[model samples]
Target: MSKPQVLMIGGGMIAADQILPSLYQLQRRGVLGGIGVCAQRGATVKALADVEMIRRAFPGHSFRPYPDPATAGDAPHPLLYKELIAALPPRQIVIAAIPDQLHHDVIMTALRNNQHVLAVKPLVLTRAHAREIEQEARARGLVVGVEYHKRFDDRSLLARRRYREGWFGEFKLGTASLMEKWYYRHSNFQNWCTSENSDAFSYIGCHYVDLVHFITGLLPASVSVYGIEDRYPNGNKGYLWTDARVIWNNGACLNVQNSLSFPDGAPGTNAQGLSMYCSGGDRGAWLEHSDQYRGLRYCYTQQPDAPGSTMFAEPSTDYFQYVDTGGPGLEVVGYGFRSIDHIIAAILRVESAREDQRSTILDEIDAAGVIATPSNSSYNEMVMEAGRLSILNGGREAVINAHEITLR
Candidate 1:
């Protein structure tokens, strides 16, 4: 079978930084064939026309402005689901990396149009929308995956293996945190950060939430959260920090703190860590730290004060340092890229089986001793809505049951 084609939606940071780069790597390796990008408006789409990195990587590919610039130029124009779907091939894979609010509509539209979809994290704002999309995808017999890159992280994957083996003994406490530089909110990417549908919790906290679930296979029973909205002068007016307690069905709990207020001048650099304590021993087998390193000269500096800058070194971790720069191999095997690749491979595998009149993709792959699974969007959406309700109710416990949330 030929390599599957790709139609990437949204020309924002996710598309540019994550989707496009990953696709370029895959394209170089002959895993993915042709590629296209589309955005609602022309401004952002036009800005990507001359992107050197993308142009250098994908030499012959060109960006296509969907729904026409004249019509979708305004903010929040009429939903262009029909028009957008009409422009793609039936077997094409739609990568929806647009805003959080539009995820449900775009995903459902693509699935209903008989195209597989790979959506970004925090698939949708609410569980209802997520379930609606999942139902549509399942009804159409198509693949729908949510990109929760943490699941593909080497350390996190190790933890998952150990947890699945029942080596953790009994469920205990899980602690996770994610911190961004103080200037992140004030940067050019604040467009979606200020929106009501997206915030620090969904933006950064979703990683840990999904990580906890993916690592331990625990279903969230209840959640209680307290979050503070951004109040800086130019900061986006949304949840800048979130603290939450998630109770699993096994009576174990997890404490999560996500913040976007880490100053650049602070002693520690960006904060990203996870620690899970089991009942078996004093030492925890699960600990993933992406902060601080030794003998690293990389530092933070505003100006070159002397021959060598004396600015403090930012938190440095070689988490994604494995790359074969010289050849046509998996140049970048970071979890972020691996997450996207996994979904694409799954979709293509299913498509290939269907073309050969196979009974089922799962059965076919299983007979061949292949094990592949993508993170469930519905599950992530359910937990996110529960967290939202917990924050809305002033940290009151919110209950979750099989991808549905109820404020208790």
Candidate 2:
């Protein structure tokens, strides 16, 4: 059978930084095939530049580009969707890394075309859209995945196992804090930073939202959110910080914050950490990853940087090694790489089955054996919209239902 084709939608940071890099890595290992890209006419230059880089690096591979104009003379020109539908082969994978709002439209089109899809989180902006995407994929026996990459992290996988084994006891509370340097928001994503499609919490908080659910198997029943815009523009312009208190149906509270207001002098590009408390049966267990260091911290100290500088000390290092090959080859593992490799493997498996007259079943299980399917994104979609509605309703509680979302 011919190698499966790859079509990447959107030429965003994710496509350039993570997705394309992983694809090229797969190509290096002899697992990838022809590649295609689609983006808006405005993004053509960037998209083509990326394609050219890949083409030059890996010669002899077919790379096609289709730039779509938002509108034409007559009907709306969804050139990307039209071209994809008309030409996407059965043995193909569509990586949807577009803005959050367009996830539903682009992903649904791919699924309706009977192509396997890997959509970046939050999969869609609403629970209904997630359900529709899932239902369509199931009906066509196609695989669908949401890029909740954190779930593939070793710490996250460990937590998931402990939760499944009832070792974490009854999950009582989970608090996650993550912040990116100001440059990321004000510069990196400046284009659509405040377009209502992307926000600090919705974009970054989706990781923890999905991670908490993935680890504890709890669903966010409602969310009470309070958002603040410190330096960025306000009122549909952009949000610099967001804090949400989510109540899970299992009587667990999840506190999540994603701030794009980190000080410029900060040491790292981003800081992230999560702490979970539980009812212990035997002895209390504490697991936490130090912010910025990504390792365990033992103590803190106070030492001034300058006369008026803030004194801070975290006795930690980037010593925690999740995977070490001691070199580079096909068995080298890291959850980030594993997550993308999992998608590639799933696509290849489906392609193999189709070619050998075997059943075409694209399993959704991750490397950790957890069920990391796209349907699990329903809660993510809910929490995102719930937070948005909460902000719109003056920071009141935004209730969510499995069937629909209501702000009260």
Candidate 3:
């Protein structure tokens, strides 16, 4: 069959850091055909050099600029969306890995065009928005697989397969945690940071939240979340976490926190882990995220009924010793890889698009809400209403707040 065509949206940090590299891989292998990119500015990602960077990895034609408005988020910029819409062939696969704020508008446009979308995780700002976008997607029979990559990793996949294969027997208990702080004081607060509802709750903790559902094949019948925004506008909680904790309805729990103003070495001195046990056997492992290191690591052990024996195991990999955190510090390098890997798999999954073209209730509602432009007024209203409901209910409503309702 012919390779899938791609339209890359956004040339921000992720484009520079991960998507550009992964696209290069797909193109070289012949799984991808031509690539057209959309960036508000004259970013390198949309240039001819980008074309050569992957499938056509060598000098080709000069980078062509779509007649897009020159300014991002500058609505008055002429031809911004119009030029982008006209620049590509219809039905090209779109990767909506842009900033969270732009998630609604970009994905909505692509879906309306009937192009399949690989939306990044928690890309929707609210559950109501997720519901609306999903409704439209379902009606269109278009695929909207989320970007939850840890679910796609070979190791995590093995764990799930073993659980299903009866290797671990029956599962009764499962637990996961990500504890480390990576907040910067100088972080930009208004545009991208203010709307963040994470002090680890959504940012750091949600990965494992979605992963548990993927690996154990169990949903959190319900979840109770608690978080505090200590660092605030000053950047106390950095990017992912300032402080947070969560407990799942299945009795599984997720605990995470950004290092408070604690003295040095507090975050590293601690360990983070995931453990699950059932009738015949049990297994658990620790996760180590490093910036200076070449890769990530996972170490786990399975034990028989006996207390002092080993059924099997995967040993840990060690490669760190803080290069000396100066003040209110964190390593940004190690944090974004998980997002990168997820993007790679999501693109591949949507590119194939040959599943039974079916869906479970859970899969269809995987999104919270889909926010789009004024044309998508219904969805925009959904987000606003959900937020209002959250505030008025004191976070007591499940129909609106999954994490908070259980607490109430």
Cα lDDT tens digits, model 2, 219-321, are 8898977877544432246666888898999888989988886665554446788888887777665556554664433322664442212334232223111
Error of 3 at 6 (Å): 1.8
What TM-score would candidate 1 get against the native?
A: 0.83
Residue pairs that clash (backbone atoms under 3 angstroms), model 2? none
lDDT order, best first, reads: 1, 2, 3
TM-score of each: 0.83, 0.80, 0.60
The reply for model 1, stretches above 4 Å from the true place, is 55-62, 65-82, 232-236, 265-269, 281-288, 291-324, 327-330, 355-359, 362-377, 402-404
lDDT of 2 at 303: 46
Best model per TM-score: 1
Q: Candidate 1's error at 185, in angstroms?
A: 1.3
Native-to-model Cα distance after best TM-score fit, residue 111 in candidate 2, in Å: 1.4
RMSD (Å) of each candidate, 1 decimal = 4.6, 6.5, 11.7
lDDT of each: 0.68, 0.68, 0.45
lDDT of 1 by residue, 260-324 (tens): 77776654445677777777565544444453333365555464342222366542333333354
Taking the candidates one at a time, how many backbone clashes does each contain?
0, 0, 13
* Stronger candidate by TM-score (2 vs 3): 2
Lowest summed lDDT window (length 10), candidate 1 = 366-375
